[model samples]
Target chain A: MSTPDPRLSINQGTLKYADLATALRATAEAGVQAIGLWREPVQEVGLATAARMLTDSGLRFSTHCRSGFFTMPEGPARRASIEDNRVAIEEAATLAAAGAAGSTAVLVIVAGGLPQGSRDLIGARERVRDAIGELAPDAAAAGVTLSIEPLHPMYASDRCVVSTLGQALDIAADFDPAVVGVTVDTFHIWWDPDVLASIERAGREGRIATYQVCDWKTPLPADVLLGRHYPGDGVIDFGPMTRAVMASGYDRDIEVELFNEDIWATAPLEAVRRTAAGFEVAVSPYLTE
Target chain B: MSTPDPRLSINQGTLKYADLATALRATAEAGVQAIGLWREPVQEVGLATAARMLTDSGLRFSTHCRSGFFTMPEGPARRASIEDNRVAIEEAATLAAAGAAGSTAVLVIVAGGLPQGSRDLIGARERVRDAIGELAPDAAAAGVTLSIEPLHPMYASDRCVVSTLGQALDIAADFDPAVVGVTVDTFHIWWDPDVLASIERAGREGRIATYQVCDWKTPLPADVLLGRHYPGDGVIDFGPMTRAVMASGYDRDIEVELFNEDIWATAPLEAVRRTAAGFEVAVSPYLTE
Candidate 1:
């Protein structure tokens, strides 16, 4: 097999079936220099033990998988979500500090969908902004950056109300760039008319927390969430986007975060190897030139 | 039974199985004042006969159910598509004149998906603009307003390259507003953050050709294309969107176009009744309020 790309960080979502130990081991053994962690696996092992495992594995952590579903009205559920997010901020900071030197203390946020029995999308989006505002101080205190992720518009009703990078940046503008930023994921925003311009703005604003790469193909699976593809496996031309991100002065590890069921069923190490190979073929070239 | 909203037009797609006669009879029997015609059924009866039947039914014609799949590169296929669009424009003018007073000669344009085996979304989009430019004169001569529609981004790759109202308006900017306008469909654009502002801009620019309404619910069907719902059944708060369109001085008949398999399976007249009822509850109040 060809050597893995050094800048490739296998986001744990790609190896969905893998637990904490398996994910880190698979990523490192596949010759990938970095790995992004999910909260479930880390919580399963408990944060302290997860941190120890990361230190021993010697792989860098690119970002914490995610933690931001605060689209609820102001109630106990909302309060609980806010408190849980505070704990997540601490977790992201601890994990980053425990990982290798290049690890980044960034947390991806999938802003929640509209509240149940509600057609108030505008209200839900406002709650996302309020949730971020409530969390920004905590993020700054914990030295973690909350990266708002705009999922594809198909998920706007039930998964995320924040469905555009420009919207994400607009929300991020209220907070300090270091404490709040946006996640640039290709699978979600590749179809956007304003995508390149948004990337340039993100870079100019100094708020691209992490850059994730994946492909989007149609005849999307029954579970739309699992329709993501390995890089170059679908129709997305990564050239302009990758170059735009590069042009934005984002010199961080690039992540491959697949959500396909077939990929999840493959062996973790094999999946990591395949991810790195796809990244090398589809995205790495744009990184350099 | 609740009196049907006078402005409610049942788009033929909602009664997918209905032939032209059946659709018109069902819609008219249900007391709906207007209807939108699809190309297939109209072609089945031949446009002239369909026009006579529409005149006989005494229902106003709201729009021509779409003909614009010109996202391919310059070739025989592109030429064929442009010619077909010209024919469609003539059909729209003929049908509009044949229908009752207040009928509109609007041909809805669903700009086609990326050409097969092509990842060039930008190129495909430009081709759509170019095709529109080629067909605008034919539309103008026929007294047909080509209404450019922005499909939901989920269909961005395989169905329509035009995926935003702003993008549609941008493309229409080059042509006279009377010749090229936009279809404001709630299902496709309700999730958009800039939707209200875009609608206002469309009105201000004199480009609001048609306003179609449908609801979006999640766990989209295996065929995502058929995931739409009647306006009141899903999570969309139509108040703001409906109010925005009303504020734009859009006095044209509003259409309820749906593509759900279940809705299609219903008898034509019942489906029309349900659409009007849904509109009555979910959208009509906002119109006059």
Candidate 2:
């Protein structure tokens, strides 16, 4: 794989609730090298129309935004989760046909705090694995790879319970390599003691399905449901992490994914522009020549 | 060692600006069984007066509040940290003489954040070990155990670098058992994946010097410096954690330590009473008959 171009890739969710065509046109004009299309946008425009627009614009397709919230242990919820991921795989496939440059890898997985009254972390993990396992064959058949994104441990309760890269890799290991992988978002795993090692391992295993960048702000409030910092503002040491990804021989587009209140409050184009600049400066020192 | 009664405790620095005599009088009347004193409080009333009050009131000293910001790596600054810890050890000895029950230990250390321009976590960890090694002998001689409190990783940048119970135990293992041990604070370490294992290990190794409790709230603002949640109001899975501590053969008082704007706004007695009530209710499910 070639070293990921550091230009810019807009995660569609950043402009959530905005008109898809307008957002796409603005993102492309802002000099973004690629765009991470989401399900809602594709659904709204009709997959065919969305695919044709991407083809006409000639923008590189980075990985799809997501597909996985496999936390419910059993019954209707687990079946519903599998069906949703299958739809996400189809969305990725549709985007791929529309002229996305990369493979149709649907980012799979969501995790959060355990169900109330549940104290069994290992058991909850098993539930995640089982849910993903059930969806793997379908994803592979649809020509899509499931990219499990491990959220920050703080979100282990209500969001994505998969809190570490290692844990994600463990779940991936249970499936055929072609069917499962991971999305490395800096915001989630930046504080991990084993982040560098895990990044390298992800590269070595060829499981680095995505590389997302963001910063970690200190004095983060006890309630962090939507309070992330922009890339340059927080204290996460991203230098070694970038180097580890590079050394692992995984060269891919670095996606700037910020979930900050300040950015969300601004115009979508403004957030995109600021994010692109932050990514360049923050990762400049560690970028491979 | 006998389990110290949890009732006889005085919150150090409760009267941050008040004279030590006044604080001690309030502590005595509150019917607190012991006092968790701070160095500055003693200085304000003069060691002679503060010592007399504790002796007069028959208050036992549970433990001193602190002594470690061991993250400054090198030269005079690092040496100063060691000397300051020594002073704290001396002060702990004085409190012990003033009717403090059992041996008095300085809350050994707080880990400092990433040094300027360096993201070398391994190197920072080494500095912590060195600081502890330098302070151990003086603390042991003063009859003060250096209780290494593993702070929350949120404080991993500017405050405490030792962010997990396991990390504290590892640092303690490098020293004489008599001089070093681990203090487990829920506020600081409740989020750790390895907390239960570490606590069990601490108990097996007889290295549990303290156990404190607090809650973690959500919708946390980006600035964590001002974000602390009162006990029973946040996402910490304390019930399971408390049960794990008890299972580890730790039969000790679970100190209720909270630092939050809401609590600080209330009268200290009210804060104490509410905290006690929260503790009883939250941990009741996990208590062994």
Candidate 3:
């Protein structure tokens, strides 16, 4: 029998349209052994029911799909966001608990964009740092790592102030490596000139929690959120980047996280198949084993 | 009478609605002593006519809009882009010849994005470097500097591959600083985490050829090209950035470059007035007389 590709994992966002049960079944039936789950879909499936289904499917969890919009204005809004992240950390712990032994349990933190009517990106970034510091203890207690994912500069205004791996690492450096790390998403950081060096530094520091892959395409959709193409379908040269991640000692599952309307519109099974096929071409060659 | 702001210049792009003569007239009348000319409008008005008009209007030429889409496929396509840039250099020289003397006549080079059917950004960037090497002599002979402008990463796929000031500097370092330099456009690089250091490096290296300012706004227009807001109308903190450019030993015109449908739709004179107002509020404080 052919060896199973242990590193291949699909983020639920690639199958965003499917219900939790259907997507999990499609993933396992396709021989993909792990997934990165989004919070909303898990909530829709009910956390307990989602956890039970994940346990039954025998697939592992890599990282939880994010919760950190801490750039909210002072008072109730900011407090609520911090409180929400605490719950996300708990949910991540639960999700990881149902997975096989040694599987990663990470809560990805996407630093929110500027608060309404505020042009203070530096201020926003500081708040993200404060929020992460506030949550690191909960993350450590829950046995889940908090991975800060730096979105591309394009998303800096409305999505994430953390626009480079360097910035994410700077923020991550303040916390314990076991509790705070950084997620490297190719779609978000392919254009950064400093990324390769940052990746090397991330590896040496033992802080690379998760490595996500998705190609970058152009004439982006009106929403821009739907702009990611599947691996090998766009402009990113993934072989070198993925190899860099592997060299960084990141032996965990390489999650294929995509957010695109066209890919999501495909039948769930086909999406999984396509993702696997893309992984083989764009990502598999970098595997050491 | 109050002293005229020598550093403030109007890039013709901010007056997308005006004819070249009207724009020049409006700019000089508004007490702006310098202008950055776009090639299309210059061609439309006739290059010689445009040069004479500038001299007559007494407005010095800061920079020529752009002329470097060198990422085209090889043979005639690539050669044609090189030839076009040569022409652009000559035109820039003519614009400078008409100036009051000692004014910089710079040609902006926007590194073209991914070649059609090709996703090799590294390859595209190398081609840009090679194209600059080939053109440096012509630019030097014409006494016009070739200024590489690294567009924002959002434009990395369809517009330009030179996505960071550091990358542009790496390319510029290979050629003579007198002939090859880099343009610092705030709108294109405001999100860069390394910008402050990059600006200092450019100053130390003597490559700060032109400094352009425009504000960054979100929910970009359907056509992202038309999404730039006037400075201070959007979220950029320009004071520190402008100060960084000046401290870089860059004593050149600060061109206010904007690309937006709404701004373009405004009356030509009002657009210039608003640009001047924005410069005074967001940028003037940092300029040392």
Candidate 4:
């Protein structure tokens, strides 16, 4: 009997230690068809060279890691975030320009957390929406889809005020689907009871830009950011979530994004292999089911 | 200018060190109108003695700590949870019978998290609903309202499957309001964007059983359970939540329940004073607004 394909892609953060070259090479060797790039590594590898590397390897750049810390207080901080996002949009365009024909390279945006010492989440969210809306035209022209990834509510106060898929869609709804959409990352959203319905709505609305997979684990790391686990290792049943997004007509690549300190400590290649296995166990069954 | 009233009712858990007698005496001396009792402390002091203490001090047993761990595997575990709930209902009955005229004693149910090694939140939630439904007859007969507390999603795995007021109300909708209702704890529900609306709906449906206040502090303790802070020490804006519950026509005593290590380490009497002050600063303004 043949083994099932995990249909996996690696988000660079899953192997935080790997350089762009090593990560790109590992993606091909790991037998995955795509890789999600973080701006820091992409820039370190030099954007032009990184884009060419992805093109040369015939690997899809599933998404440009991020660009949407638009929640900072107004003035230089806010202006800087918008300007940086513009550059990210341009980078996303270059990466998507070389992907598999119709694949839309997505720029996953983690709307910045609350400004230091500011507890005004409502105001922060409004600022994020305005910032994203302001960038939509540039995103449309560049052919890069801006995907709003709502962080978990635990991060609502200091990381991202957008804590729900419904909230992400609310902001995305105000822009063109070609320019703005929502990313569904299981680790961040699985706890949401309404997530399934939200994914369905995003699908029907043609706003499902990307689907990132990871499991939610407990005794969250002190950093909290390093707490994400590979699929099947935690309480989250990725089957329901994966199947829901799939049923929503999301046929695009699914990236197994882990931020665990343990996972990152391993060799990037070995981590990719384990991620593939985890994905097969946790998510592949649902694909067939 | 006079100091604002805390309108506080300390949950015995807030002072986990305090015995029932100490808790009762401190609550009365703290100038608060009520106290929420945990079963262990009540049983330790003997139910009859605890009831007499509450009566003697003119303190209302705003609620009985809990009864709902129905998610355990079937057989002894499940039966034990139901049986325990029955005893708690009886205890709640005894406590409520001694309350000041017009006060309805509540049984705050922290629906247990997922059963050992299980990951089915939906199933666990259903089991909770069924378990609560089974106890409704006893609750009705005893005149103790069963409050289904929707804990924060962070606790959905091991503490409570009901993670939102909407979910709690959904389960409660299947039962009698006089028997089953929902708890709105600021620490648990503050992260929910739609909590205000859910509170209003709970009020309209007459399912608002109790209101518990505490602030949500981050860098959660190793044991996330101890992460709660006194109001105003954290990011939760209690004014909107307090006013929403108030506007819902809920006139029952509000209980300030903290399960923080720092709070527990304080002298019970001193903790009461601090909790009172925190409530006045974080919640009193909303009462007037």
TM per candidate comes to 0.99, 0.86, 0.95, 0.96
- What is the DockQ score, from 0 to 1, of model 3? 0.71
Per-candidate DockQ values are 0.88, 0.31, 0.71, 0.48
The digit string of per-residue lDDT tens for model 4 on B1-289 reads 2342645678889989988888888877778777888999898878898788888978766889878878876698788788999999999999888866645669999888877778787788778878887889998988889999988877777788888899899999998898899999988887777888999999999998999888876677777778888989988878778888999888887888888888889988788889888888778888766
Per-residue lDDT of A1-289 in model 1, one digit per residue for the tens? Answer: 8888888999999988899999999999989989899999999999999999999999999999889999999999999999999999999999999999899999999998988888889889999999999999999999999999999999998999999999999999999999999999999999999999999999999999999999999899999999999998999999999999999899788998999999999999889888888999999899888
Most lDDT-accurate candidate:
1
lDDT against true structure, model 3: 0.87
Report the error of model 2 at residue A32, Å: 3.1
Candidate 3 chain A least-lDDT 10 residues = A1-10
Instruction: For model 4, state the Cα shift of residue A176 in Å.
Output: 1.6
Winner by TM-score: 1
What ranges in model 1 sit over 4 Å off? none
The CAPRI category of model 1 is high
Question: lDDT tens string, model 1, B73-179?
Answer: 88899888888998899999999999899999999999999888999999999998888889988888889999999999999999999999999999999999999
Candidate 1 chain A has its poorest 10 consecutive residues by lDDT at A114-123
TM-score of chain A of each: 0.99, 0.91, 0.97, 0.96
Tens-place lDDT digits, model 2, residues B42-93: 7767767777887887777667777777676787988887788777888777
Overall lDDT per candidate, in order of appearance: 0.94, 0.70, 0.87, 0.83
Better-scoring candidate (TM-score), 2 or 3:
3
What lDDT, from 0 to 1, does candidate 4 have? 0.83
lDDT, candidate 2, residue A240? 80
